[model samples]
Target: MYQKKVKESNKNNIFKYIFEKRKSFVINDIAENLNITFPTVKKIINSFLKQNIIFERQKVGFGVGRKAMEYELNEEFCYSIGILASSTKLKFILTNAIGKILKQQIYELKSNNCKAEILNSTKDFLNTISPEVRKKLIGIGISVPGIVSEEGNFIEFSSKEKIVLSFIEELKNLFHIPVLIENESNLAAIAEAFLTRNSIYSTFTILTINEYVGISNFHQDSLNNTLFFKAGRLHHMVIESNGKLCECGTHGCWGTYVSDKVLLNDFQKYFPSIKTYNEIFDLKYHETNIGASLIDNYLEHLAIGIKNILFFSNPEKLIISGNISIYKEYIADKLIEKIYKNHIFYRGKETIVFSSLNENGSIIGAAMFPILDKII
Candidate 1:
């Protein structure tokens, strides 16, 4: 039993270590970094090659002797479906074994029957996948803006639905496959970090500033770690003692301050015709006195929430994601300045940047979850 456990542990570690490491790593290099014997690592590599789980790339010359073979995860080995649902948006993506996106469709959530839209979109996604790909289809991953149960399956409450658990359960019965669900923010952070993690930062806190708010932390090997899907609840954390009232019937919740809805609502008071964030990002708006003041106030409030995130978790890098990422270029300097503008004695110096993945993080993460689950 002990020997079997150790062997299994080594196999899992090798898989995760390679997935996190830079692409095209040689066998000897992996053995050295993982502190395993060369023969043992080579044997494991042979097993992976036989299973077609990983494949060898071009050999690299070692300057003196036999050329070493480079290897990488075989992306074509399997596929997963990722679904991201929010109050105002819906997205579906097909990804390979390692989370490389293959096909995608996005839609605006304007209809009254939210669950029906999700159901139809899911059915469409499954129907469109080729029969060859269906053979490799392992499971489906779901990300949503709501409080998910600790088991990572039940969605207790969402803005539009009272109990989404039944709908999710029905999906399992209809499809007859394993399904995993998680809070959108948590999955977004995972998706972003999975693609972008590097040696400079092992930890990242992702803040999704959409019509609603969501936050989660990710590490290079975040998939191996267990996470409680409570990030959805963090949106309701009160930042002010008695500030603006939130729709949840609370005062000073962070959502009431930095959320896209609050910002758009405040913008509407000055420009009633503005329906979406696209109109608000125009530089000409920043030229006006009222517009400048509104942005400044919004930036300050956003800073407050970021500072709160820093104080509690202190991740090496804080990423700004979700709908706000669409306009990061316009507000990057101002957002950073406001975050560092005040509280010299209190705020910690943290590297903050906008995710290059933009708004696709949740869907990618959602798809990546089930694929990674297979490896573990």
Candidate 2:
């Protein structure tokens, strides 16, 4: 038993080192970095190659007569499927072990509360992937807006299996592998942090604005979701305490000011024909557009919530995600000026910017969860 545990530990540590490096490594490099025995590293590499988890990328000379084989994760074999289940949309993202997206698609949800419909749609979506790719699927990752346990289910919200447990099991049966789920905000934080794996700020906070507002703080090396209602509650933070009414029957929630509903409701007034963020923001011009006209008020409300978040969490960095990022070109500097100006509680050294991954952050992070499980 002791020998078996040691071997497994050595194998995991070595694999994790290689995975985090995100580069090709020789057996010596793996052994040296992880302090594993040369023989143990060789044995594990053989197992990984046979399992098709890693492959020999090439041979590198180490100043010796013979060159050593370079090994790296086989991106083709270590793939994942991500599903984002939300109120109005069921989005799917396919990605490799390192979160490089292969393909993604979105479909409107006929009924958000219907579990059977969601599962059926998922089966149909998976069937769309090529048979060859399916054979290589390592696992399926799920992202939901509700708060969930680390085991990745919405049980905490309702504490009932009916809501999402069976759905996770069906996915496990589908791939014969792990099916992990988590709060979409946590996953978004993971995706954003991973993208900046080499960056200076490892501890940070990220805010996403869409149909609602999601706020997540990521400390270095942490992927755990730690909020009561998390971003959902951020929507109801009551910046104004007695302002605009919310769909949840509340007033002055930060979401009431900046959510898609805010713009959607206003846009419908002018261009009743159009109904999505894309249509509104992608118009030929926003200079005289309703969407454009709503900017100042939107930014003011947005900055207030942002200032509150920074003052409380005080993360190393703050990022804007979701459709809100689409306006980065127009709002980045303007938004920054508003947040920093006349702020007494906020101390500087907090970096604020927009995510390049923006809209795709949740799905990409969801798919990468299964990949991250390999090392975790």
Candidate 3:
């Protein structure tokens, strides 16, 4: 019995390895990469083929030897829905087994009518998906900003209550599949780790700067237990003892200085017509004085926040995501330069990077949970 269980576990690991690669692999490639015997790898591949969990693709020529058959995940074999609930919008995405997004829909949300809007939008999205895709849906994953209970049954959002018990219950009844909910920042970090295959860093910190600021730490491809909920509440962290007031009723919080809203407010004063962070970034490239000044100050405050994070966590890599990452080249370079210039402790060691997943990291990460939960 123990041997049987071990074999089953190995099979599952092989299956998961293929999905994570997100590409075709031959029997020898799988065996060598996963450190399994060729015979065992072949057996697992055949079983997966028979189960319709994976399928063969065109053969790839290997030097003078006969072509080797490549196998890839049968993406349509299963699907997942990911919903990102923000203060202003609800973004829904459908992803296949390999985490490729098949379809996406967004609906504007109202503070007062959030519950009704979400239910209606979700139903509309469900109706629009192809029947074939819906039939294969394994589960739904919801990503909400702010803290989620460890059990994922409760939420503590900074904005209005977008994801409540009633909403969760309604979704479960409607879908009748496993539903996973997680904090947006945590999901973003997970997405970064999974999508990059840990190429970025096995352990790092992700800072999301949008309407609100969010921070989460990932260690060895997983969330660090020490940074959960209250500990990871970076937005409320006091950067200034007597600084500007924050919506959280705190003075000198990090969010007040670096969030998109704050940046926009400062930008609007100089160029009232300029709308969107993208435009500001574009203007900066033109050497506009106002644009340069705004970005300089933004980078300075951001550097301060990052320095504080380093003081505590000292993460080897820092990933900046959300609205700011859209200007990855500009923001990352400036932030890195500022950190190196200002902070003596992290002058040359730490690596600062941008989220390769961009804005979709949270939604994609959330969508992957349903499939990941079963595999991992």
Give candidate 3's error at residue 345 in angstroms.
2.2
Query: Model 1: C-alpha RMSD to truth?
Result: 4.5
- For model 2, the superposed segments whose C-alpha errors exceed 4 Å read 1-8, 57-64, 149-167, 170-177, 198-202, 220-232, 271-275, 289-291
Residue-level lDDT for 321 in candidate 3: 81
RMSD of candidates 1 onward, in order? 4.5, 5.1, 4.6
Which candidate leads in TM-score?
Answer: 3
Task: Please give, for residues 285-369, the per-residue lDDT of candidate 2 as tens digits.
Answer: 3455556767777788889988888878776778788877876887787788888886675466346888888688878878987
Per-residue CA lDDT of candidate 3, range 126-203, in tens?
Answer: 899888888888888888777776455556656445345556777788768778777777878767766774444656
> Cα lDDT of model 3 overall?
0.75
Cα error, residue 287 of model 3, in Å, equals 3.3
The total of clashing pairs for model 1 equals 0
Model 1, span 219-297: residue lDDT tens: 4433444432236466688989888887788899888988878888888898887887768877766558888899888
Span of 10 residues, lowest total lDDT, candidate 3: 222-231
Question: Which residue runs does candidate 1 get wrong by more than 4 Å?
Answer: 1-8, 57-66, 107-115, 151-154, 157-160, 164-167, 198-203, 217-232, 239-245, 268-275, 313-316, 342-347
